[model samples]
Each structure stands twice: as C-alpha cells, then as structure tokens.
Target: MSAIDDLADQLARDALDAAARLGDDRLIDDISKAIGASSPVSQEAFVSAVRIRQALARGRAVMDSRLTQAASQKAGPEKSGG
Candidate 1:
C-alpha cells in the first residue's frame, strides 16, 4: 500500500481500538449524541475493520462542531471591536 493508504488503515484500526476499549455501548451512545441519529445504531453490527473508521467519522463531526463553535465565540469579541 502507498503511504496514504497505510495511514488510512492505521487510523481505522486506531478508531476500532478506541471503540473497543471504551465499549460498544458507550461508543454508540457518544456517537448517537454526536451525530443526532434518530435511532441508535448497533455497535455489534459494525465489522472489526470498519468500526474505527465509522467511529472516527462520527467523532470527527463532533470535534468539528465544537471547534467551529469555539472559533465563533472567540471571533465575536474581535468582530465587536472589543
């Protein structure tokens, strides 16, 4: 695999490890809350190779939302000339 492919594979495994260490139930809860899913997605349904990939995607969304909010808050004072 190319370097980029290798990195992608590594990240997927890392996410799977994180999910497993945290437990499927907990990861599902956090992921649901983060993604605002209408219904809970079953952790058991995830394949080993895909668990981390899915979790990372969901987690990244939450992180992006929080970071955007923080940046907006920080910019508010500047925008107001404060």
Candidate 2:
C-alpha cells in the first residue's frame, strides 16, 4: 500500500477508537469532513477504511452475541433409564 493509504487507515482507526471512547459515533463524520478539507484523496481512502472496519466490528458483535447465547442455552433433560 502507498504511504497515504497507510496513513489514512491509521487515521481512520484512531477516529473510530476516539469516537467509541467518547461514546459519540458522530465524531467519525466530523473527522471525515476535516480530512476532506485537508486532502480529498486521503479522505476517500480514510472513509473507505472506516466503513469497512465499522462493518467488521458490527459483524463481529452480532456473531459474538449469537455464540454467547448459543453457549449459554440450557440442555434438554437426559433420556430416562429403563
């Protein structure tokens, strides 16, 4: 990857972390706007990285919830002895 791509990914990751840490996802959009102002190319790459990462995070959460629920389910009664 080019230096800009790496930098964009890093910036996107940091934005995600900060937004989550502050409990304000809107920060992602706000940061994106700022990035666009400085460098549209970087902003595009950064937005794409942010979106892909965000989707991954959501997918993981969904699968994790299902796995936890499945694991915690109670087993049915055993067959009775004759």
Candidate 1 per-residue lDDT, tens place, 1-82, comes to: 5554454466446555677787764654464354334423322223333655777779999999999999999878554555
- TM-score of candidate 2 against the unseen true structure: 0.79
Model 2 stretches astray by more than 4 angstroms: 74-82
In order of appearance, the predictions have TM-scores of 0.38, 0.79
Which residue pairs overlap in candidate 1's backbone? 16-52
Task: Kindly report which residue stretches of model 1 are placed more than 4 angstroms away from their true locations once superposed.
Answer: 1-46, 77-82
Clashes of each: 1, 0
Judged by lDDT against the true structure, how good is candidate 1?
0.57
- Full-model lDDT for every candidate: 0.57, 0.89
Candidate 2 per-residue lDDT over residues 1-82, each given as its tens digit: 8999898899889988999899997998998899899899988999999988989999999999998887767454567899
lDDT of 1 at 78: 56
